[model samples]
Target chain A: MEKTIGNKTVNVSEDGYLIDLNEWDKDVATAIAQEEGITLADDHWKVIEYLQNQHKNDVPLTIRSVGKSGVVDIKGFYALFPEGPLKKASRISGIPKPVSCI
Target chain B: MTKNIVILGAGTAGTMMSNHLRRALDKDWKITIIDQRTEHHYQPGYLFVPFGVYGPEDIVKPIEKFIPDGVNLKLGAIDKIYPEKDKVVMVSGEEFDYDILIVATGTDIAPEETEGMMGPHWQKDVFDFYTLEGSSALAKKFRDWEGGKLVINIVEMPIKCPVAPLEFAFLANAFFEQKGMRDKVDIVFATPMSGAFTKPKATEKLDYLLNEKNIEIVPDFNVMAVDGEAKTIMDYGGKEVSYDVLVTVPTNKGSDLMERSRIGDELNYIPTDRATLQTKVKENIFAIGDATNIPASKAGSVAHFEGEVLLENVLNYIQGKDLKEGFDGHANCFIETGHGKALLIDFNYTHEPVSGTFPFPGVGPLNLLKESRMNHMGKMAFKWIYWNMLITGRHLPFVTTKMQEAGKNFD
Candidate 1:
């Protein structure tokens, strides 16, 4: 499936995650954040930015790593991404889903 | 030089192993995973089916969808495993040679093992949620249930998703309350265990949940049989618990092929080195998930954690290197306590679940052994993660293959 993020159309999986990493950008992320009902604050951006860096490097992004990244603690990360911290944060960061989350 | 790696049963453990090994091993290693089923059933979601919280569509997906690229998915029933030859034969008489074999056949519920459990009352008043069909039938039964005695029992231990029966009772309590029929339903939880759960600290919290919801816990009640005609479950001591609805978790056993191969123990589970997951019969053959006689919870999370350790050991075996004894039996579960609240517990072989903040000590967004709405949401969100992440062999960020005790409170 595909979702229109701003003026760009990006491929999304059945779960609404970015299928192609190349199609992701700030505009698409902003659009995804809006769709998820999260207003991307600076704290949210910290987690998102850290996730995007890790995704770019092809490293797995776990909640603990995000907490250890000095960007945010586990509680603050959850506060930034309410329901599913790793999932929601990864989605907003436009990365492939990390499997170890639960 | 091509080498073959054959994995039996492409369910939770099998699927994850395929993905993990595919990425970790060299291109010379050819991985083939075999399973009889085309569809992959998310076993944990079976608990919610009875309460209508999740439907059939929510829990199932194609096994091929999760099978990683560069891996072969062989769909067939196994005939036998010849450990001496390091080869597996299918029921169709086809044979495949392997340099290494991973038995991840997992376990199945055997309700027929108990007397009268699957009698005429089954799918009418008695049901088992461990299977898809039983769970679906219970859903319809719960829809029109006027409510009387609702008894949830465990016929035996070492069942898949061990906490599912308790989760059902908690959800039943919430389901009834949502329908305004809570007063009419008399919920009783019958278990062979001494408490509401196995772990002491976690059990303390779960006992409180059962008490707070007015659900009775009949612990140490060894079920002998079920009088289906009379709608009562009989214990060994001849005590009977009457029920309008009987939900049971039957005796779980490994594949019949395990017995056919003669490498299995009395219960048909392959005897394995607990730390290395290598079968006692053959160093070339290993077992993971519910297939091994490892003293680990038969939960998906355990399989995911085991996948990490197994991948490392498999590579070491291929390279003629020493296998690492790193598997700590790390297992964790999110317990649903109903009314939009849930509790999370993390533990391993040596550590019982304790009260503390998870991942980041004192900075947890999730509390251990404490009910919270976030935990419930995490439980719900797991279905998504199970499908997208875990099966794809993605390394979870902060979680380790072994249990960590830095933030845990034993005091």
Candidate 2:
């Protein structure tokens, strides 16, 4: 489905995740973060940028990788995004949610 | 003039390939499979050990017993593989030059990765069931345990048999109830994922099962360290969950041999072409099962499915023919929900497990993604099928390498 975020219509999944990374923008990320009761800051942007870069390169994102990415530590990432930081930050970054083998 | 085709790790994947290639290839090809261990364990049976459903003797057999008559089973630890020279060196200074190499050295639990996991309380109050030693130790622990705040934690993602932790919680729920100590036991499932499982539909179904069984769920809890003194596991996010007894599925990493050989990723898993099972190192080198970072479940069933694709691709590589992209990451596993019931889930890289009938479609004697006594029977019967048919390179009747989309409920 498509939704308007900051005067722009973007496609997203049923859970409000961006369907296309190409469709994602700073305004979209800020909007998604704001919906999660988070205010985008310099720290959050750094993490988001790290996640987006990894996604673009076809790398799977884990809390472990994010913690080890030299961008931020796990504790700091959690403090910035609060509960379920990995998923929350991922949605804001306009990437797919993390999944493991079933 | 016979060509050498060497296979490393005589576990499920390597053993199966040896049996497969031995039967398929002519007398012109010599197949040599290597392993440090002599015992070939029925790994899936490890889950049943702690519950007293399966004894150690039942799950283990001599590794050589599975090796067919024509294939040579070399028992030795692999030191390193010099892929450029097409040779493998042993720690004992043995060497084998090969025209083709197969890497089936699967993943193993690394409890040491987490701080204090191997500490004073290790295998005493804290346990891991991924190994025969740990499972047997836990069996003894559970035999006399009074039961209070039982915590089962999966430290990270991509562990072997991802559903095993959930099954442990479910079985524990039933185990205590059978012992008439259900009230005394408070079971909590702590995991890194945000739900009962990784997939949406399966997670919903399993989450319902957790609720029905009264098992508490603590989601998105990534372990940072274990405080043995406090009997608590603290996540990186500063969340703490205390436990009376903690059963953790530690971080799983591919064999250390991968790191030594410099042919693997950070986790020591070999990078392979997902569909072709061919490694990035060379055309003659291949990988299967948990050893390869192929985005498939690290379970026996996945290995079984990958075996078919690998066999074809290997033969093609030798004959100078175009390789087939036959592998679709098909994996089918029986999710044991305890108390004479289980759920059978069949899926692949593209498809998630859906509710439907299995092999027989609508007329299925087995169900998919739904619990049934019939499915439980199928799971139990799998033990015989594994030893007699699976590793022997015999195919299951009506089961295909690619997942069947028919009779499934997909929205």
State which candidate has the highest lDDT: 2
- The best candidate in terms of TM-score: 2
Q: What does candidate 1's lDDT look like per residue over B1-411, in tens digits?
A: 999999999999999999999988888999999999999999889888988888989988888999989999999899999999989999999999999999999999888877888767888988889888999999999898888999999876667878888899999999999999999999999986767887777788899889999999997566768998888888654568898988888878789999999987555778888799888889999999989877778899999999988999998998899999989989979999998899899998878899888777888778888899988888888898888888787877677788989778986
lDDT digits (tens) for residues B1-411 of candidate 2: 989999999989999999999999999999999999999999999999999999988899999999999898999899999999999999999999999999999999999999999987989999999999999999999999987899999998889999899988888898999999999999999988878987778999999999999999998888989999999999877899999999999999999998999998767889898899999888889999999988888999999999999999999999999999999989898999989999989898888888999898798989999999999999999999999999988998999889999989999
TM-scores for the candidates: 0.79, 0.97
lDDT of each: 0.85, 0.91
TM-score of 1: 0.79
Show the colliding residue pairs in model 1.
A62-B397, A99-B389, A99-B390
Which residue ranges in model 1 land beyond 4 Å of their true spot?
A: A1-102
After superposition, which runs of candidate 2 have C-alpha atoms over 4 Å from their true positions? none
DockQ (model 2, Cα): 0.55
